[model samples]
Target chain A: MNTPGHGQEERTGLGTFADNLRKVPRRFIESMFRTGRPDSDRSRNDFVFSNFFLHVQSVRTHRWSLRWSTTWGLGMVALSSFLIATVTGILLMFYYKPYPEAAYQSIKDIHFVVPTGRFLRNIHRWSANVMVFSVLIHMARVFYTASYRKPREFNWATGMFLLVVTLGLSFTGYLLPWDQLAYWAITIGANIAQSPREVTDPIGLTPHFDPGGLQKLLLLGSDEVGAEALIRFYLLHVMILPIALCGLLGIHFWRIRKDGGLAKPEDADRRLGGPDPEAVPAWTAAPRKTWSLAAVVRGRTPAVGAGAENTVPSMPHLFYAEAAVFMLTFLVCVLLSIVSDAPLKELANPNVPENPAKAPWYFLGLQELVAHSAFAGGVLIPGIIIVGLGLIPYLDREKKGTGEWFGGPGGGKLVAWSAVFGLGTVLALEAIAIRFGWLRQWFPGTPQLLITAINPGTVLTLIYGLYSVYIVRRFNSMRAGALGLFTCFLMGFLVLTVIGTWFRGPNWDFYWSPSQWPGH
Target chain B: MSTHSEPSPGKPSRLDPEAMPRRDFLGIAAASMAAGACGFAALGAAKLPKAAVLPSAAKKFKVTLPESLPSGTPFFPEGRSVVVFKDGDRVFAMSTVCTHLGCIVKPAAMGFDCPCHGSQFAPDGTVLRGPAPKGLPWLSVRSAGGGAILIDEGTVVPPGTKETV
Candidate 1:
């Protein structure tokens, strides 16, 4: 109340009655944001610390964290899209019916009848898509920055699980519309769930121990996608997965705080007791200048004597930056929603399947693998990738260039070459796999187990592994090897996803372009 | 309650309540309580999975072939995933469910084409082109005494097994 700005606001408002009306809003603002305006350093710190929502973040953020190039704000964009999806998804729940008979019709009603329903649904769909894309990019950013190295390793593992949960949420939501696209896509998903049969059946253990059948049953709640599966997916998409995501996200954010904020070059420099050539100029000058009371007494805290040398308060700087990224994400999703209607295909018919029934676009890459060998594509390869990605931080223990993109200097060239090598190898392998068939064609009666173990997915994984080892020996650093390996996997995923989405046609047959598809 | 209990030979000990250590007594009591709680939870959970009402359709269905029906053309029964055909005096039904991944296969010019992963099957339910390790399964069929053919989807007949009509 004593602040000059507060008095000036009171004087500018019309007389006592109008001023009384304005007081209500001012009081509301004051009560919610106790630090008011965040004009001074003290107020800025108090602003973030006093607020429940903003408290998870550090009161003062490293300047690097505020830089658009440092993190690209991809994580914030993902969080924004998720919030949009949750809000819109809840709104959709009011109108959506989960029964098979009513589901498709209700979606039609949502599209054409309910006020703002189409726009809301479109936004939900687009934001979910945005979340998936941004999450992938965010992970790539974290990896390229080498932020997962030590003290932040568990967070990386948690992030991988979060990725799974995200994909799970998206996949489960796909079946809610109950259109041909939804039905067929889920059918493909169910089949993928049952892919272990490729190994089980060949070994004659299917009758005794049928894990794939159990998986399929659990996923669909029956033999196929029907009313039962619809309700199950509805429960998962709207409730279970979201709850899991919230819990994991809480850990993810908290871990970042506990790890002494985002990784920076200064941290490694401080550890090594040498001036990092790449360290921000201010960091070297104010090495012992710390504002935290913990600096006085702490055993092995991540930042026992860390200094806030080149940092800005979270209130106006970081908050405004995050808000900008969030707004940009929302704007992009909104524009996409306005321009393109979310697809609603014909009603689901079990009798007549779509010519080339495909899973959700994100899963199409796995589906492409499934075509080669169901067990390999659907189960084994994805399993290996998940476990491998989770183990990355633990495996690569390099401490130099912690926060620099591509782990500083020569890493850029290494990554670029790795990307080219990855893209070329995948393209060549895909061409070979398509033109000349795999083991099944070469050997008239190749066992399913052999094919499952030695398909294109396995080949790609093996090549990536071997090449990564070579890069390690060549560069004599695990980080360089990781950069090479991660780049290759990224490129391979992109290429496969592209092929699956656009190049593959009816009967899962390959074509140079969609235009060349038969009957197109 | 018995005021005195015997300490049995070859057993660690079983005596009056006063003789039992507090730690062991509490541990045993807590374990039993936990077990009881878990048992009740299991009992409640066991009832959740089994549906009170059965699935809408039955496994076995009846279909009558037309007098002038074509020999080789596939005839799909209503609400069923089986395709039936009559060749001369022999009648047979094959499952439309793809052996590869269980997608309902569509009858095609070559034989049957799976839309999910493109596993193809010959007319006689043999794997022509695969990802499908085996072909579409032939369902057991029997005449229902009135030109009506009864197909048992639950039963998988051998590849060439046909009903004589």
Candidate 2:
């Protein structure tokens, strides 16, 4: 029974034809991906350089890059998810209309009529969630590994821009379904955009210099979310953002290559206190391998003259790892898509608002922040975070640990302490805010500026900032301090997001569960 | 690029005829022309938002009060962002647009409740619970010589102002 092809009776007609037909696909893949068998280093190099997709990657990858624990393949997962979303999203666009009166009906038709349409929409949706989640984790991985050091600083900035684009894509897409969820979420978004009026109005500057009004107009294309807003968001979600992402992604990958293919310790060359280099013979006979032509060109190729001691050809090693991650992402998204349909609620009605209307899950944390003060939560905190995250590589210039998780043992301890402090403070403040209420409750008639300037959100931000400063003073290391501050912000965001998603009921009031919600 | 035009730290100001080089002058001229072109383009772009034509529902409409609408009970007119109340012969209309962010408010047992941020307003359009800086605006109302009354949503009347039949 175990013998290969034991049940097969050698067929002369249709079976032989079927066997040959099966071989056609394998041959096609072979022709596309390989110049020859990848058994030798030269063949593997050919496999990488000759293929269009593989050509973007280096001929060889460092051993550190191959470790599952190093990157967890999160970047690969994000890219895979993005690819899936693009394919399914384009398919969806074939049926979707960008008018207020037609959008909801179109979505319903896609759900009920179009063959495999629900599955396609679900895949697009779940993959979008997967992409956002994986991109976040990838950023965390980069931060923890201190991969955004001197040479990769600009790359890190590029990553921040890409992050914003990702969120923008998600947000604009959120309004497309034109359901209650989509409508209210975008309404909240529009309101958040107008939060600058909270400040401008207080100073009597709104009449002459109304940035908030301008923003809302640009975003919605009118005073409210209507046909114009729908068309504008549709244009952005499908065309502009995706194109911008592709351009930025090109720069990101190019920068990665220029930065010498991911950070590693100085001892990675195996000439210092590190382990002995692999015994495999070199691809080229030079004592120190280099891309001579690339080095002679205008820009410096850092990988050139970097000895290939503990590196292997990327064709099978790195390619296999990347392909495995892609498959995993695809499998997970498909499974989730099959099990759960993407949400499509009642048609959007401006006259009726969903009780406790909430923003998309990713922005729920900011919504929770908005509960304290719209300006502080919606505008100021997000502004600070974007600017802050982008400036991290520049701010934390210490070069002690470049490729280690949590930047080594001491850094891990700092992250733990910071996380605990951040989570504890946020929880306590939320509880107090819920129980005793904020400045508005305690001191009625408080000016909007005072309320906007000082709330739980601002207080938490100030605490985290000062704590980060103190950590820097105590440890005398910018990396350690940056680690602390980043961890704190991350923890706070996670906690607030959870509370906003689950605990807040109608009127944004706290409830233990959905069962406790009024009229539920 | 500006090195030629920069005065050295210890040198006196250059007041000579050739103080600004031809290269610098030409560069400035080209840049200014480009800047002027951009300004004109921006001026044209600014006109895009003002919307030459606006399609909106009639701001003033006649609303007939239902016989079943109890005194002091709010009655919502079809296809309008307004709530009208009648008590005996006195009648008033209030804009349902939430002052916080212009969300349409739903009438509650007590008053109007905003669904956007939970800004509540009293029966007389006074602020009850707020992120709403002010209460809902009272719309101008006038008797139309029949059971019907005209509500002008485009016009804002003083708070508590009412029209008598």
Candidate 3:
């Protein structure tokens, strides 16, 4: 191989030796070990590929501008969670004995003996919380942007499942501390799960055995919150959830390729012939060939026009920006973790009762349901809502397409207003019921009222059912295209209600105990 | 470059048009020389620091002294140490915490080694390797009452100080 500029003869030294070696089947090794000059494309690629921090980024396409931000946001959250898990997990590992007796004491050691142990644990706890928030927000962004439409629908569905798993991961991890807060919170959560089924036989000849009691058995692996529960939760949190998330994430990325980058509404609408094709090219050419799987999947045949060959790949710019955003987000998570450690209450003493047993904030929506009749709010409602959310893709059925591709400004308003009025009415009515003590009639007395009032399961079911009806009606009225806009209000309301309940304090309590049975 | 004088005669003057005025020529020459000198000074300054110390001979050590080194003293040229003293005996030692990436700094002449990224430190623990922000920390030591060496691990003196350890 001739050396450029320095001359062919000049390559007689190490340069020629390297060139000669390149002829051998050691190309993979050469590439693997190669170090390029800084600022060169090769070097930047290497940096992104090899570096741990940068590797998670390196997304391929630039078709969707905001899509990059979404991916970046999600990726940052994941990276931050990983970092927190690593730091806290390692610190925790030092003191965390997997055995039931040792687990609690290990946590104590982490709090007392480890240098900055509390800080590490807090960061891990808070980052886990923030990761859930980010992942949800990322999903919402995808939904609002219509990123889940068409070919990407399966990935979107997978993402939704991942979101649930993420929350589950956070919830399960919370109990590992084994303190009073963790214990009671999980207890309340499990009971809420049992409430609906528990009352099924009340009208029957046999004494009604709470079907919901099964939840306790399943969650705790026994009658009460004890050693078994802690180990079960720990294994789920550390091992199960991470594996599920990793698998889903793989599918999510692959779908991006299969579905074609981010959905551009203009291009999507054009494909369906709802819009003028002359206004833009039939298909938006991906920014770069290298970043796109288009050629491999769709074949190299030219679909639109000639000049498509010259486009630059999206890898260097848009993907780079995504990386920058991820870094920024991770930095924020670290800052938050360092500043706020998750509070751990006094150790669990089963004999003692903390007056207002609270559930995790996410579960507060369900707690709110318990304010209604226990059967309606605690059992039937949440079960229905979870089932409904899981079946959203099948139920909605209208092919709206993905991202910005399904364009139009029609009928969205009617759907939006309908959902706003319907879901909004349920939340408002529930709030009113709790404040005015209207649901007390069903419970018989204070104990009964506490059991029945503000049942989140019921409230969620009612809301989901009503919204589903409104959605179906709106689409039947030819407002299908505007579902995203219509649904936005309900989403906002749910968020507001959750936030409100979180800040509401003691008066909003809903957990039950045998001694504090209704009518007491 | 010669300039011919004008022929003195009634017939014609033959002074070359290219001959510049004496004052203007002198001014231009002086300006050019001044600019040249400035450029040379900048070049010299740029190269001076690197040339002054041979890269191979750069001294780096962790300074741990039983006796207190004053604030301005250079302990190790580029190393860091934790110093402790008992009764009359003074002892100081270096830690291996790498300045970059928070990895444990390893033992080197003046300072430590960063295993994670392969950053080298001078004996005084100044970064001999790229990517590190600063040098190793110097454990300051001072003689307090009762003849005990008061090792002030908290105070870090800047590099290149002239005071003795």
What local lDDT does model 2 show for residue A145? 94
Clashing residue pairs, backbone N/CA/C < 3 A, model 2 = none
TM per candidate, chain B: 0.74, 0.78, 0.37
By DockQ, highest first, what's the ranking?
Answer: 1, 2, 3
Which ten residues in a row are the worst by lDDT in model 2 chain A? Answer: A293-302
Candidate 2 docks at the CAPRI level of acceptable
lDDT tens string, model 1, A279-360? 3333333233333531222323334555544556677888899999989999999999999999999999977777678777
C-alpha displacement of A64 in model 3, angstroms? 2.4
- Preferred candidate (TM-score higher): 1 or 3: 1
Task: Score candidate 1 by TM-score against the native.
Answer: 0.86
Q: Chain A TM-score per candidate? A: 0.89, 0.90, 0.73
List DockQ for all candidates. Answer: 0.34, 0.30, 0.00
Kindly list the per-residue Cα lDDT of model 3 for residues A1-520, writing each as its tens digit. 5657566366557876888777766666556545443254334445455544334433323334344443445645665565556556666766777655466677777777778877777777766776777776676566555555555668767876777788788888878877777776666555555454434433442234645555556666654567777777887777878788778877766566555555555443334444222322213533344323232333122222332232223346555555676667657766886776677677775533343455566655554444334355445654544455445555444434334422223344544565666566656664565445443334333333243334444444445556645655655622242353336434544753564354443323322333442331
Best by DockQ: 1
lDDT of 1 at B49: 55
Tens-place lDDT per residue, model 2, A52-111, is: 766667777777778788799998898999999999999999999999859999999999
Question: Where is model 1 chain A poorest over a 10-residue stretch in terms of lDDT?
Answer: A293-302
lDDT, model 1, position A135: 95
lDDT of 1 by residue, B1-165 (tens): 677765556446535334667899999999999999999999888657534444545788888988888898888888788999888889999999887766788888989888777777889988766577676889999999789989999899888898897
